[model samples]
Target: MDTQLLLLLLLAMVLMASVAQRFPENSCAQYFQYVQSGIGSFQGELTLGLQNGRNRIDVRFSQLGAHDQSVVGALLPYPDEVTVRASLRAAKFRVSLWADASAVLPKLTRLVYNNNELCRASEYNPQSFFNRFFELHINGPQSPHRVAPTPVIHKFPEGQTDVQIKTVVFDGSERSISHILSDFVNEQTATSAADWAPKSPAITSISSSAVPRQRWPTSSVPTISSIAPAPWKPATPASPFIPNGIRASPPSSVPWPSFVCGQEGTGVPYIQRGMEFPRGRYPWLTAVYHKESFSLAFKCGGSLVSTSLVITAAHCVYKIREDRVLVALGRYDLDNYSEDGAEMRDARRIVMHPEYSSRLQLQPDADIALITLDSPVIFNDIISPICLWETAETETEAEIGSIAGWGTDENGNSMTRYPRVVDAKIATVGECARRWKVQKILDRTLCAGNLDGSGPCLGDSGGGLMIKRNNRWLLRGVVSLGERSTVDHCNNNQYVLYCDLAKHMTWIRQYIS
Candidate 1:
C-alpha cells in the first residue's frame, strides 16, 4: 500500500482508541447536509465524510475515547438495514439509517439465530444526524438478547432464478433457516405455497416435497403491485436493497462509536491522521517571519497570491513590534533556508485594509492586509501563485478546504520542523456566532476548522483557506482573529474566523494590478 494509505490505517487504529470523546462533531459532515435539509422519511446507506479523522468506532464492546459519545442515543445501532430478502436468516442484527425512529420500530420483528432470539431493541435514545435528529436502540450480546449467529454457508441453486428459502421449527419454540436445494422446483406450485408467509417483515420458507401441504400457515400473504415504488423510498423489510459496504463486516455484535466532534480543549488536536503533506504540493504557503524575536521565529502565515503580493492578516503586521518581517516560500523545511530550492523576499510595502485598525481587527473587516514584495517572484512547480475566486454565485459547492503554514501551539511549540498542511471545513454563520463570542460574524466574514486539531494556530494568523476549482487552487478566505475559544496557538475543535476574499476581490484587484 502507499504511505498515505498505510498512515491512514494507523491513524484510524489510534482514533479507534481515542475518538469517542475528542473527535470534532460535524467536522466531516458536509456530504450529508442535503439529507438533513430535506424533509420526510430518509432510508438508505451513505458514506458520510468522516475522512482522515479516526472513524466511527464500535463502543459497545470496547474502551471509550475523548469524543462526546454520550449523546449518541437514538442512532445507537439498529437492525433497520436487515431487509427481508430471500436469504435473511433468523438471528442476526444489523445497523441502518431511518429518518423516523417511531415509524420503523413497529416493523422490527425478533431476530432468531441458532434457535435463540437476538437483537430486539429493549430501549432507545435520540441522536442528531445533522440538523435533524435520529435514534438507535440499546443492544448487545450479553443483554436479554441471545448469542451471535455463527454463519455456515451452503451451496444453493442459481440457474433460471429458482431458489428455495425454508424456515424449520425445532422443539416447538425455536426457528432456523434450512436452505434446501432449488434446481428441481416447479413454479406454479411454489407460487401457490408462498401465499402462506407474511407480506411485510417477510420470511421465505419452503418445505420438503414429502411434507404435507397442510403444514403451511393459512395467513394471507400480500403481494406488492408489480409497479416499482419511487427510487428513494425507505426500505421496507420486504424490499430489496442495493448492496452497500456499511456495517457489513466484523459481524454484528459490536456497538457503533459516536461521530460527534467533541474534544478536550487540550493543545489543538493533531491533524485527522497527522499525514504529512507531499513536498511541493502547496507552493504558495509562505511563512511571514519576524526579525526582532531572533528565535528566527514566525508566528503568522501568508499566501503568495500573485507574483509580487503576499496576502496575510492585518493584525500580523500590526502586532509586529519589529521593523523587519520576511516572507519565505517554495520549500518544506523552514529551519534550513538553504535546503534545495527556497526563496526569501523582503516586504517592499505594507497595505492594510482601510478599515483595519489593530484595536478593532479582532472584530470585523479590519483583519485583512497585503505585502508588496521588493521583487517579482519567479514561478515554478515548487512555487506559484493561486487564482482568486470570481463568480456570480458567491456560494461554493466545496465544503472543506486546506490551510498551510509553518506554525505551532499556544507555547510556540511545533511537532514538525517543516511547514505543514491541514484541512478545515466551512461552518455556518450560526456556528461562527457560537465560536466567536466577542464579535459578530458578518456576511463578509467566514469560518472554518475542526482542523482535526491541526491549525488556525497562533502562527497561522494570516494564512489562506484555499479551495481547488477547475484545476487550480483559488483563494477563498484569509486567516484572521480567533473568537476567544480559539485564540490559543492551536485550536482543535472551535471554528476560526477569516476575512472572505470572495467579497473583497474588487479591492484586491485594485491593489495588485
Candidate 2:
C-alpha cells in the first residue's frame, strides 16, 4: 500500500469518527440542562428531554452537603443564592430549550411533562398554559415534591361534572371506594349522614386520565418518561379532587386531609337532640384530647385531615396548657373508648391560623387551627382523613347541614355520656350579625341551627358543623361561638356560629404542605 494513500485514509477515518461523535446516537434522547441555584437554599437541576412529540422533565436539587435552614444565602453576591424568595416574585423568568424541536416539530400534540398532559393545545388553539409547573423526584415522592391535583368540581358548558379518579384497577387490593363504602353501608342500619348516597362521576366523564386507552391511536401507549417535557400552563390537569392552586399536584396516594365527601343517612339514637352516629358513621370525626400528666380528656371535637394531620379550632387547643395536646380519631362513644377504630397520637406541632387569637373563649373570626400528629395514623373505614369543601355552598340542598358533638341535651342537661349527631339549617350571616351585634358575626363566621332550639350547645366548641354531599362529609365550619344566651345552656332556638372552613383554605394548606 502507498504511504500517502494510507495517511489520507487514516485522516478520513478520524474525521468520520469526529462527525459521529458530533451527532447523537439517539436523536430522541436530546436534552437541555439549567443549573438553578434555586430560590433561598434550594439548588436544583431543571432539565427537559425531548422525543417524538413527547416531553419528560425533572427538576432535581443538587445535594450540596446537608441543607442548613439557618444558612442565609442572601447578604452575599450573585454567586451565592438568596436565603429568601421575595426576589422570585419580581423577576421575569426565561426557560431555554436547547433543541430545534420547538421550531421543527409543529405537529406536537401530546405532552407528558412531569407525568401530566400539560399542553392540549394545537396550532389553532394555542391559548392554554400551566405556569410554574415543576416536578422534583426526591426519594420517589416520599419526601416533599410537587404533585398537581385538579379540581373535583367545575361548571361545564355541557352541564356535566369531571371527576379525576383513575378508572384503571392498578392494584388487586384496591377495589372501588364505592364498593368499600357500600360494604360498610350494608353491614348495619341507620346513619347520621344524609339519606342520599354520593353519585359517582360517570367513568366516561372523568376528564384527567391523559386520554383514555380507547381514545389513543392504535399502536402503543407511550410511557411518560420516554417523552420530553413541554411548557408550563396556568390550567391544572383534569382531576377528581381539586388542589385548586394548592400544590402543583397531590401526592400519588390519596392526598392528605382526604375525608369522606357528602354522606348523610338516618338510623341511630342520640348526641343531645342529635342522633348517635352508627358504630363508625363519621370516620374522620375525631376528638381533640388534652392529655394531662395523669389524665386524658377530650373536650373539643376535630376532624382528621390526613394520616398525620388533624383540623380543629384555635379555641380548643390554644391555651389549655394544663395537659399536652393530643388528637384521637374514630372514638364512637366517650364512655366506651374501648370501642374499635379509636387511636390517640400526640400532636407533634400545632399551627393556629396566624390571625386566630381565640384564647379561652371562642372567637368568631380566625378560630381555625391545624394539628400535625407525631406520626401518620393507620387509616381504616372508621378512622380516615376527610375532604375539605372546595367550594363554599352555604345553602346545601334544602339549606341543611349537620353538627355532631357532646353538647348539652334537650333536657337542659350537659352531654356527658353518649354523644349525638343532629341536622341543622344554614342561616344568613346578616341575621346572625343582627342577633349577636356587628362585631360578633365576623366575616369568617357562619351561623346555622333550627328555630325550635336544635343546635350546638356548651362543650361543642371547636366541633365541626359538617355538610353532606356525594355520600362524603365535608367540614363546612368549626364551631366557634354559640349564641351567648345559649352558650351555657342547650338551646336550638339560638343559631350556633362556626368558623367557615371553606373560606380559609389558603391559610390552612400553607402549613399543611
Candidate 3:
C-alpha cells in the first residue's frame, strides 16, 4: 500500500475508538451547526424541527395547575437559527441543525478526527484518564453531579414528626429520580423496619377482574361517636278539595273569584280592549273600576253599532225577561250603584245576530247576539260607541284587533263589572288556525291573544271584537263562549276557540241597518 494511504487508514481507526469512549453505549452523536449565533436560553418542554434556513422549536408549559390554566407562546425561531429543546421531566432532549454544509463541515471534521481517535486508542474504557480527557473535550465534565438533599417533615398529632430526605438530579431528567427518592423515604422509617410491621390504614383495592376488598389496619381500630335519635312530630289533616293529598289553601297573594264565568255553561270569552287614549293622554284609563249592577240585567256585553242597534251574544238575551234586560251606557263604575253617572236605558227589543244560534250546541267560536236599544246613546266622553263591523278587505291574522268588555284575569277573578276593557295584538291567521284547529278563524273574524295573555273571559260574552282599521277601532268579533277550564284560559291552547265575527258580518250588517 502507498505510504499516504496507510497513514489515512490508521488515522480513521484511531478516531473511531476515541468516539466510542466519549459517548454512552447507545448515545447518538451528530454534528450540528447553528445558522445564527447568540440564541437566548430557553426553558420549556418542546419539539424541535428545521424548515428552510430556520430552526423551529415549539415550547409548551402549563401556566397554572391542572384546572383553570392557560398556555402562551413567545419568540418563534427566525431564519438562519438552530433550535434545541430540553425537557427534564419527560427525559427528552432534541437538536436541529439549521445551517448549510459549508458552515457545518469544519465542526464535524474536527470532532471526528480528534475525538474519535482518542476514544479508539483508549479501547472504549470511559473510566480511563486518557479516555476521560478526550470525553471531556468532546462533551463536557463527567464527574458524579451532586444535589443538596431536600428534607420533608410531616407533622402528626401530639407533635410527632416524620422526616424524609429527598434528592433530585438535574441531568435533564427528573421523573425516575423523583420516584426512587419517594420509595426510599416511605420504606426507610423506623416503624416500617420492624419485623412484625403494623398494617396500614384500610386501602380499597380497585381492579377490573376482581371485586375490590378493603384492607384494614391490624394495629388499631378507630373509635366512632354514637348519634342521638330524632324527635317525633304529629302529621296534620289534609283538605279533601285539593288533590295530590295537599290540604294547603291557595296562595293568598292571588285573590280567587267567588264565581267563575262559564262554570255553569259552556264558557265565556275574556275580551281585552285597548286604551281609548295614548299614554298620559287620559290618566283615568289607569283608574280601577268600581262594580255596580243595573236593575235590568243581561248575561252579555254589547256594542252600540248604531244609536239604537246593539250587537251582543244571543245567549245573553235568550229567554230573558225584557224588564230584566237593561242597556247600561257609560257604566264604567261597577262598585257604586248610587254614584251619579250616566243612567242606563232599557232595551225596547232584542235582535240576535241572524247567524247567532241558541240551538247550535256551543263549541268555542260561534255564539253571537244583537239588541236594539229603545233610545240612541248620546255619544259623550263617558258614553262613546265602538265602530261597527265592516267587510274586512284584508282579514289576515297580522291585522291588529282588540276585544273589550268586563272579564276576569287569568285566575278566573273578575277585574271589573260594568265595562273594563283590555287590548291584545291579533295573532297571524296561520298561527291561530293551526292553534285553534277550528276552521272558524278566517277572513271575517280574526283571533287575538298570546302576548301578555290577552283574550276574552267570563262576562265578556256578547262584548265587541274590534280591529284597528286605518288607525280606527272597528268591531270585528263578539265575545262568545270560551273553552272553559284553567288549562284553556287566555286561549293558550291552540284548541280553545273564541267567536269569529267575520263569518256573520253580512247578517250583522243587515240586522243592525
Candidate 2 minimal-lDDT segment of 10 residues: 71-80
- For 1-513, candidate 1 gives per-residue lDDT tens digits of 699999998888655533222221222121111121123322221222111212121111001121221111111112222221111222222222222222221112122222222222211222111111121122222233222444432221322111111111111111111111101111011111110111111111111221122111111112212332123222321211111111213434432221110000001211222234443456567778777646566657787765567888887788553248788866567667664446777777788788775654444465787887766554332455555565423663226666766566434565346655666667767767776564556777787766344445656678788764322356788877553444344555567677888787777666654
The Cα error of candidate 1 at residue 307, in Å, is: 1.7
Q: lDDT score, residue 116, model 2? A: 40
Stretches off by above 4 angstroms in model 2 are: 1-186, 189-271, 321-323, 359-362, 392-398, 437-440, 484-487
Model 2 C-alpha RMSD to native: 22.0
Model 3 misplacement above 4 A: 1-298, 359-366, 415-419, 428-430, 437-445, 487-498
Clash count list over all predictions: 23, 49, 35
Pick the winner on lDDT between candidates 2 and 3: 2
Score candidate 1 by lDDT.
Answer: 0.43
| Top of the candidates by lDDT | 2
TM-score each candidate.
0.44, 0.50, 0.40
lDDT value, residue 280 of candidate 2: 45
TM-score of 2: 0.50
Per-residue lDDT tens digits of candidate 3, residues 1-513?
A: 699999998888766533332221211122222221223211121222211211111111111111111111111212111111121111122122122122211111111111121111111112111000000011122223211123222212332222111111111111221111111101111111111111111112212112111111111112222232232121421111100111124433422111100000000535433222211111011111112363323345666544455666667667665555776654454565442324456666665544445643343334665555655542222333444443434444444344555566555555454444454445666776676555645343445654434556766666765644322345666655555555435443322244666566555554432
